[model samples]
Target: MPNAAPEIRTFLCRSDNIGVLIRDPGTGACAAIDVPEAAPVLATLEAEGWRLTDILVTHRHADHIEGIPEVVERTGARVTAPEKARAAVPGAARYIGEGDRVTVGGLEATVWETPGHCADHITYHFGEARIVFSGDTLFTLGCGRVMEAEPATLWRSLVRFLDLPGETAVYSGHDYVLSNARFALAAEPENAALQARAAEAERLAQEGRFLIPSTIGTEKATNPFLRAGEPALARAVDLPEGTDPAQVFTALRAWKNRF
Candidate 1:
């Protein structure tokens, strides 16, 4: 029999950073995706009555790791961090690289080195569960800013996601759906899917709900970053037809940077 999907909880921390908790019901083993803040994580764990067994560090950003010491001290949860960020994330009990598998009880995740927002960034893919914890690498309607690598490097990481099943649920690090929706519309104004998605994003925001766990299919149709290969997006960026998708992606990222 297939393993049951793990229970997931999503909440906000530190204004915009997302806090995620995933638990295996059979073993009662829980893991926090990243520690943006200790208080909310602790409170959520207590309220849910889930014992945390691991802290999965996505990157070495200050906001992501600042609450680590406190959370680990309190829960004794083992830390799994990216190998490239060993120095910045001293609390890591295990430094993992691409293809490393991490288990929270019976639930398992495969690590993928997806560095673009920062060199140490990694994404956790729970294959059986069809879930991805895409840290600063990918967002709902946007991808992370090209910080430490070239635009093509980030494009490579983003394209890696395209191979996943469309039903795969993507949990990104931050909630920038509204702003990204606006930019997506600007980048592809004639896209009906993007237009509807932007409208839905506004409604979700008004309801104090987050547009998270966006499916790979939704992003493929609506996210401008993912649609760089499309002729409409290429035209929007003032690029001629048949331009390299990477170049179109570069132009889109530059425009988004200024948007």
Candidate 2:
């Protein structure tokens, strides 16, 4: 029989980063997406009373993987990371690449190489669950800072997510909705949807609530990074009306870096 969809939980760690957990209800197997710090992850697991069976690393960045050792020690979870990130992350038991698969008990995650933020970054897609662990590639209304990959390469990665089903729920690596929303408005100040979303994000921030778990359909409609090719965004950003989408994307990234 096919496995049941995994249950997802998101929590904050290290101020701005967001950590994720995916648990297969049928098998009672849980996976930790990245361990910025082990304390909160351990605490969360204890609270949920779920035994962690896997650790899924998205990149080699310190904040993303520093807690792997402790979490692994505490949970005895199998560690899986991008091939390049394996050495940096201690206790990693498996290395995955684009098109590779990682099983969290009966739940299967198809990995996609997304190297814009880091050369070894990857995103996980659980098709049956209609969910994606986007890591730092695609954010709520923005994309990751281009640290290694070329601008064009990152653009391609961002575009790839658009092809997924429109309803796919995107759980990005950080809680950057407030800042990204401000930048998004600068890219499309007249967009009503963008305005409303920004207001909601601001309200959520004021209330100290999480502002993530955005949908692909929502991002496609409001995310400035994803809409670089659209005439409205191009015009708002003062780029030529018909500038190449890739160039617009490059400009947007540069602008966000300084914003």
Candidate 3:
């Protein structure tokens, strides 16, 4: 039997990104994932009637951490982000790097410096919950562009993230489920789970719902990027079978950037 009250709860914010708000209902304290803007975060805090105790920023992107200053000013919550992001982020009270851990009430989140989407990107792992705030680093069926790092470097980064426990819930930043699915389908139509997930994503999009915070096991079952080393991915992208996973991985992301 599972403990119903302690399950980490998350929901959509503005229908674009899945900003998770985890609070100990037992204590009424809260923590927010990446805050794209201050208003919606504040609204969520208001609705829960919980005090904003902390903010976790995964990267320094404007869309990810743009609302930091305003929120910090109002709530005075402690802020934690990657060490490299300290220069870019405003109002961060504590800087974190790989292996460091932070706690919000009873829940704990470990920091992993996963830099590829940007030179300073990081992922926050809610250890006990088996959840990670992946930012733009890892998506449901896609990963972020290798803008700040080379394809090889980005490939290594993605591979490292994939090594996490399979059941870990991945809460990414953007809502790319449907578009990623279309591209994944084009890249690997034979993937039955991807096809089914595409249908589900299409339905969710049409219903004005969000499709994010998917599990790593599910991504392994459907996400082409997560399956970069598979022969099916090789065929989908026209790469020679048994090519270096890094190369195949590079090509897959490049194709999606265009798609």
Candidate 4:
């Protein structure tokens, strides 16, 4: 079978976080993921000779947004972001929310409202690419903090992503693998996959490399938050036997927040 031509270049930046630059082969225009700062993102675009076509902001955190002004000024690119983030995220030329689909370069990206890291946080799912830019909601080995939502909201919100295809590649806003791994071990000491993942993450980080782009399958198998209702989680968090599924999930998240 013939290999597919590459359509994007994902740059790991800002303390091992990411700013993905997706290029349109036909127009040479590029779209970037959460651009925390200007110079690095611009440098990557200039180096590749790709023009900026648009910007996609997963959420409105400063670390994820601080660069939009310069990016808009330099590229004359339109910004597409969550409707609720218009105030928090400047230069949002277009607003998107749940069930909205944004098209670029023969690809269609679907929006998902993922409100835990923040109430207005969103996930962009490029189904054809089998990838999702999870902002701060879902991470490699753990979920984001329950800052914007309560235990209940976060619990149900988390279940939404659990239904994604097993092979979907997750790209989070930051690289917290090392810390998240330790937390997972505390919560699910008996999970062999968690132990194995810690070692692999350590090796990758030691080499100054990324341990991301983890598949949904791997997360479902090892991520403690997603396994919130499992026996190990229930026992570790002191939830009584046969608790309600949602309550079990809440207990697990509460414990992890303190973990």
Candidate 5:
């Protein structure tokens, strides 16, 4: 039998950063994806009556890891950080890389080193549950800016996600759906599906609700960055049909930088 699906809660952290809590119903073991801020994380844990057992670090960016020390001091949670970011994340009890498995109670996640926004970035994929915690590397309808690696490197990391089942639920680090929707429309103006999605984004923003956990199928259809191989997206970037997908992806990312 498969493990029981974990209960997930998403709330705002500092500014636009998203804080996520995953609790395994079977053993009551809980984990936080990243500690963007301690107050909100601690409050949420207290309210939910879940004791945090693990802190999964995706990268070493100050905003992402700044609250780790405080949270650890409070909860005594064990931390799992990227091997490359060991020095940056001082409280890490275990440094992991690609192919490593992390468990909380009966829930398990496979660590994937998806470096593009930063060299230490990694994604936690719960394959059996079809859920992924994509920290900064992949967002809702948008990918991260090419900050550390070349655009091609980021493109490669994004491509790896395409291999997952379309129903996979994608939980990203930030809530940038509104901005990403505007750019997606500009990139693929003729896409009816994208037009509908943009309208939905507008409605959600009006109600002060966020668009999170977008499905891989929804992203594949509406995310311009993921559709760089499509002829329409290539044309939007002033590239001819059949251009190398990576080159098209590079052009699309460049356009997004300006958008």
Candidate 6:
């Protein structure tokens, strides 16, 4: 675990999307993870008085990468993106893959290729910082829709996150926690933790506050998608006890897609 947390600033962009500014305080190196837009990000940089040194691209989605050009033009930050989705981020200085590490201000981020939302989706794990930029692969009380891979494949990708340290803080690409909480409650209303989380998510939504940076431990306890293998969730979903977790996850994802 990290002795001190890095300086992180979160704001909304493109209405429902998330924008993140990561800073290494010691050396003053900062990164923008998936530029949803450039103006707000630049304003935040100016307010914080931190120079942007890196632009970490998680996937090729338009909302995620659209602001890259302007951001790079203004800050000259080095761009890193997935090898397969390089086209979306033209002129990206680096193409990264699983196990590749990118260093900024001496802080290292190990890349994990979590390709379910998109065939080339990737996540960044800053283990020492106990922070994971999960991209679209994982979210608070939810997981990404299996847009470019099989349900089982997506389940495997989610499992990768489940293996992270319990205290690992997760920052996702979007702010979808309100609807996710509703779906989780519908799927497992009997869960006390889920009920409590739903209420809290409602409160946050009503206040227009951001609902992210949730921890791995909290997701395990409150997220039905993460609890597919558990007997309680299996029963709640009307699947027989001991059913394959992948099947339950597939059913849950299908249900959510329609919900």
- Give the 10-residue window scoring lowest on summed lDDT in candidate 1: 1-10
Measured against the true structure, the TM-scores of the candidates, in listed sequence, are 0.99, 0.97, 0.93, 0.91, 0.98, 0.97
CA lDDT for candidate 2 = 0.89
Q: Which residue runs of candidate 6 sit more than 4 Å off their true CA positions?
A: 1-4
Q: Which candidate is the best by lDDT?
A: 1
lDDT of 3 by residue, 74-151 (tens): 898889888898788855788889899988777777888888889898888876778788888888888888889887
Give one digit per residue, the lDDT tens place, for model 1 in 59-123.
99998988889999999999999999999988578999999999988888999999889999999
| Each model's lDDT | 0.93, 0.89, 0.81, 0.81, 0.93, 0.90
Pairs with steric clashes in candidate 4: none
Evaluated at residue 159, the lDDT of candidate 3 is 76
lDDT over C-alpha atoms for residue 164 of model 1:
95
Clashes of each: 0, 0, 0, 0, 0, 0
Q: For residues 1-259, what per-residue lDDT tens digits would candidate 5 score against the true structure?
A: 9898899999999999999999999999999999999999999999999999999999999988899999999999999999999999986789999999999889889999998899999999999889999999999989998899898899999999999999999999999999999999999999998999889888988998788989899999999989989999889989999999999999988988888
RMSD of 5: 0.8
Which pairs of residues collide in candidate 6?
A: none
Q: What tens digits encode model 6's per-residue C-alpha lDDT throughout 129-183?
A: 9899998989999999999889999899899888889999999999999999989
Judged by lDDT relative to the true structure, which candidate is superior, 1 or 3?
1
Model 3 whole-model lDDT (C-alpha atoms)? 0.81
Residue 77 error for model 4, in Å? Answer: 1.8
The residue-by-residue lDDT of candidate 4 on 1-259, one tens digit each, is 3223336666666765677777657556568888878888899988988888888998888888888898889988889989988889755778999999986666668999988778889988888778788878888897778787787777677788789899988888788889889988988888898899989999998898766778899998899888876877778778876667678777777777676
Write down the TM-score for model 3.
Answer: 0.93
